[model samples]
Target: MSGLGDLVARLLGRSRAPVVVEDPPPTAEQIADAVRDVEARIEGRVPAAVTARVHRITGTVEDMVPRLDRFGVGDRQAYTVVATATSYLPEAVEGYLRLPRDFADRRVVSRGKTSLMLLCDQLDLLAVTLEKISDAVYRADAQALVAHGQFLADTFGQSSLDHPGPGAP
Candidate 1:
């Protein structure tokens, strides 16, 4: 409703609570952009290990964006990619960035690993997982190519010349 309508309603004792409209979840492209933004914001602010892993994750996510349809909506891989960008990656970096650099990088916090080590481990995990997801996304295309090749070979008939004996000259 317009501001005037709201005022009139309030004056007439018909005041209602303001309606809250939630934004829809971001598209795949937006998620990828968010990852890139995270990478940009954290460059040189975090350890080189962290920065490198962030780049790897961002690149993998961008590659997967083109084949997201293979995952369909709400698939776990899709959800993971989105969450890794919007939540997981940012949270890990921010948590590390919030700490004093000396303590984060030197003092062991747990399992004999400093905050930097822990964050690197986490980022490495994220990078590997995203790479796997990207591979799975493209595997569909690879399978299609194989299937088409088989269809062509079968339809055209494979000649003996196509596969000679192991001892043949």
Candidate 2:
């Protein structure tokens, strides 16, 4: 039995399996673009109401800065409200929320250790939002959208990872 186990282990270890460090799943921009493409392909198949709601929600967020900034809270807190409110919107709204900003080219990519830290910060914000939101369905959707946005922002470009910093990809 020991010999057999050893043989199996050796075989497994020796197998030159392509060491695939799956480059962290396609960034959110990638996913959002795919979703939009599918929506476009389907054309009128997706409900008009859903599309309308998504547009409306995005419009609301686009104009939210004044109200959010007026409260004297930090960007993270303001983002929290944005994330939560987005959850209540329709799925289409949630889908569109994943779209990357037009200015992704401006972000600076941190290599190695710095990249790791920024990645950790992104994950922490995601976890925190999940824990804070009460509604399960909404929570899940919001987290997904938030994660997508973070990825898109990162892919596009981010100036800062800390408080009062520019938004994440």
- The per-residue C-alpha lDDT of model 2 at residue 147 equals 99
TM-score of 1: 0.75
Scored by CA lDDT, what does every candidate get? 0.86, 0.44
lDDT of 2 by residue, 51-113 (tens): 443343344344443345343444465545454343322232333334332322223455533
The number of the candidate with the highest lDDT is 1
Candidate 1 Cα errors over 4 Å, as ranges: 1-23, 155-169
Model 2, position 81, has a per-residue lDDT of 45
Model 2 residue 44 lDDT? 56
Tens-place lDDT per residue, model 1, 30-143, is 887888889888977887778888888888878877676677767999888888888999898889999999999999999999999999999999999988888877787899
* Residue 81 error, candidate 1, Å: 1.1
